[model samples]
Target chain A: MEVLAHGLGGRTDLPLDAVAAIVGGGAAVAASFLALTVAWRRPRLRPEGGRPVPARIARALDSPALTWAGRTVALAAAVFVVVVALAGPGGEKANLAPWALYVTFWVGLVPASVLLGPVWRRVNPLRTLHDGLCRITRADPAGRWPIPKRLGYWPAAAWLTGFVWLELVAPHRSDPRLVGVLIIAYGAVNLALARVCGRDWFTRGDGFEAYSNLLARMCPVGRRGDGTLVLRTPLTGLMRVTGEPGLVAAACVLIGSTGFDGITRTTYWRDNVDPGSLSAGTLGLAAAIGVVTVLYLAGMRVSAALTGEAAGELPGRFAATLLPIALGYTVAHYFSFFVLEGQMTFILASDPFGTGLNLLGSTGHRIDYDLAGPTLTAQVQVNAIVLGHIAATIAAHDLALRTQPAHRTVRGQLPIAVVMVALTCAGLFALLSG
Target chain B: MRGVRLRTVVMAVAIGVAVTLAGCGEPAAPSGGTGGSGGTSGTGTAKSAPATFTGPSRKPDVTVVSATVSRGKVEIAQNGVNAQGRVKVRRGATVRITVTTDEADEFHLHGYDRTLKLSPGRPGTLDVVADKTGVFEAELHHSGARVFELQVS
Candidate 1:
């Protein structure tokens, strides 16, 4: 009668040698900033510069049939999960729906987007459903009303927060019926919004879509103005990101959620924070997000003042630089879960309804817990967090060079660089301590 | 050019230092439990009292056994009265855990892969030799409630 816990469970990492890892990470960031200030004079990450993919390949990727196929596969998977969630046994071991959503989809999106670009946009079932309905009705895919410009990505940010709360804090997160209901509610709400707002709803309104798109900015494979596939530097793609409203909130939600995930696993959190009460968990999640947002805002304000830019506009302007940091935390926190539980997804898929049907021939699969030992896991976590901060520091420095005068560039970036170091240290500490 | 070269050298030195520091901070290897601490030190330490068997049978050393459940909440005795954070024991120690619940449920100890069926008012016992050194989860299978973390140093 042994069963896996609701969340990914294993030996948590031993507490990091905090003094060494944090100080080292901080020093590296500071040194990089100083070197960049002196040695790097020009802005190198220009968005318009990229080598286009060969014409044949680009055309094949752009084909409407390919897009439809992707949408179909995504829709079919969603429908399967929904069916199983409704009828499958309530236990986590007996259900494939939770594994598919949490491990395969949520954690899998990081590497998938990084390698293949924004796959979710092409494969989002709700968007496909909306488009199909529109075609059937003889209406334009773009809805009657345009989404308000001021609304921007705020709804997506709110939705992202709500999703994290459900995944990390909700008592019934592993309950199949609850998950199924939430999925249906999420899809229905987004589909209705898309009806009024058109295709733009998926880009700036859907939480998962926005999350995928943001991470995709770090992907080297992108499209040009003519929809031709191109190979570009990740930095170039990141630089092209526009300062959209609510971008800061969205980024903070990502950073904060991952931070809280790490903290919730620690002995301190487990012992002090009552497991039965949702209040402590909710407050902790909010506090983590708040701290990240406040620190980011402070850095932006300082940089803005130094560069003679508008303080009010700094948050959105600097938001894209934090994407790498978010990506780093994500990779560090979810790497093991993705590796271990991701295998379980295949096993569960074989008998999704718990009727013992071995459809995929994966029923014999066994999860190898020793695939990643504690030492290796700790090393990877530290490296990811540190490397991500380094990437963010470089991006911020380059952005400062682009925005400020030659004399002011270094001054403007100093505060932001320090903030990046602090954030890196914080991320490292959380991983190690947790 | 001089400033560029100087900055390059400095950056290289800083990176070297960072890498060196990281390498120096490799975590200590998991060791046999011996230290006495009332609470978990976030690492290996036997924090529980030596077990006392009431029966005529003299068995191996039992660190801590028996946990009570009421209204879906689990309570284990640390010093001997109330349940708390974790039950820490030395490696190779024989640990027998008995769980009594208000409802019939499956009790599972993760990592060790031990399971028991607990009937209402009847205590179910799971005996295991703590040969492995790590923290394993003790949980109620049906309710998915974690009873406590078992740390075997």
Candidate 2:
């Protein structure tokens, strides 16, 4: 009955009655599917159509001065984190590097991107540095050779998988020096790739950039290809996601990583899985990803066969539907971790070097656990998971209508809808059973 | 208007489901309240309740239980027989755990927040009184490998 330490939020006694949460989640998704099938006939989300933002507001947001300022701030913060990580005390208590990477940057990026629309792309320090180096050398930043079109987002997917493995499976992930070294290594590799691939490399190659850009598609406020700031429905923005190469793999990685995170904390995993073997943990992580991929691909195949569409085209066609589900799992798994340990970033910012100098006067601040008690945490987790499933169902239904003939739409989506329900149940079980 | 109505219906359904789920679980109660007191009563009376000790001792004089934790297994001796399970101690009992691991790790006892650094082949010992009656996780800090649960009751 030992409450295992899963993530940043210590000992989460989520007061969710497992049966009720799972049942409610499954029912909610099923109800949403029925509602969509009955009421929704045409594809409502139009990616190309949006109301233009006011001239004054759009001008300010797109200003060169604002972009430079954001880049400067991001670069300065990156430098500060590196300094502290290298020079500061190594433990989680004294070091801010781990908290910054895991809780703040990794988890915080989700809400930030969803609200602000690809904030990381605008403020990415590595991109700025690469551009600066290109300027100094009087050379093209996009490198002499072009990145092949077929490469697509595969590199981003691979790198994302590697990053998650480091976070969830690596033995010394919490060590500040190790985190710092990884950050430096990641930046070096990406910057070198950026020089050859040009600035477009970040759009599809950088893992964090790809992650931010994908989430940003759901943001209501987004700039069109012509740099016109427009306000659209969130679903409209989500419709803009293209099914590029490895998009399915990327989505599965997101879903499966979160799945592993939840399952690893359960009594079932603890009692059954070998704790001391790295191979066991790796297998568990891979199996979770494999299960999600297989289930999603199977659903898409059934839908494709019914609709008379190519099976190869179905993955990317239905990839956008997974975003909400991924976002849901991210929110459910990291909500408390972000709220509680996110504060540590600010506290550690005050004393980055673990020296007594209180730079930000936040060194003495304590995290308020009452902000998310067990009851409130459980409610949010359940609601977020269920709502996410509902959103996914709607997104999939809309896509199915747009892709398939009107006569085949409902029948084609039936299997996928069932898959969504099952995934919702699995998600709820992970959150509650843990 | 149709979109708005559909959104409203979805919202209503979500709220209804949330309410139903919330109603299924009991409200959160203070940790170690009646449960801890009851467990103390069930166990034999304390021979001597130390005046200064109201909580788990930072340092305690106790029998050191030797355990070996590898990548996936926790090996401990029980009654001269090797067994794999959580460490159990009575409430108010002073307890010490000496652990050896195949890899370097920061050994952490969660509820107590006591930490020990264990290196490969090198054993580390942690001592604390079982002042609280509850199940607490003991794990490797970075790797997140659970060594065992310390069930004190």
Clashes (backbone N, CA, C under 3 Å), per candidate, total 1, 7
How well is each residue in A97-188 modelled by candidate 2, as lDDT tens digits? 88788877888788778767899999999899999999999989868889898887789889989988877777666778988888999999
Q: Which stretches of candidate 1 lie above 4 Å from their native place? A: A1-15, B1-106, B110-113, B119-123, B127-136, B141-145, B151-153
For all candidates, state DockQ relative to the true structure: 0.09, 0.07
The DockQ leader among the candidates is: 1
> What are the lDDT scores of the predictions, listed in order?
0.73, 0.73
Clashing pairs in 2: A142-A198, A275-B71, A275-B72, A276-B71, A276-B72, A277-B71, A277-B72
Per-model root-mean-square deviation over C-alphas: 8.8, 7.8
How closely does chain A match the true chain A in each prediction, as TM-score? 0.95, 0.96
Give one digit per residue, the lDDT tens place, for model 1 in A1-434: 22222244433434567788888888877888888888888988777778998889888987899998999999999998888888887866668788788877887777777667899998999888898889888877788899889888899899999988877777767777777888899999998888887988899899999989988887778876666688877756677434889888999999998998788766777777765457987898999999999999999899889889888876887798889889888877776566555666677787787777878676534444444455655666776787778778878788777777788888888889879988988887876663
Query: What's the residue-level lDDT of A24 in candidate 1?
Result: 88
Pairs in steric clash, model 1: B76-B83
C-alpha lDDT (0 to 100) for residue B117 of candidate 1: 84
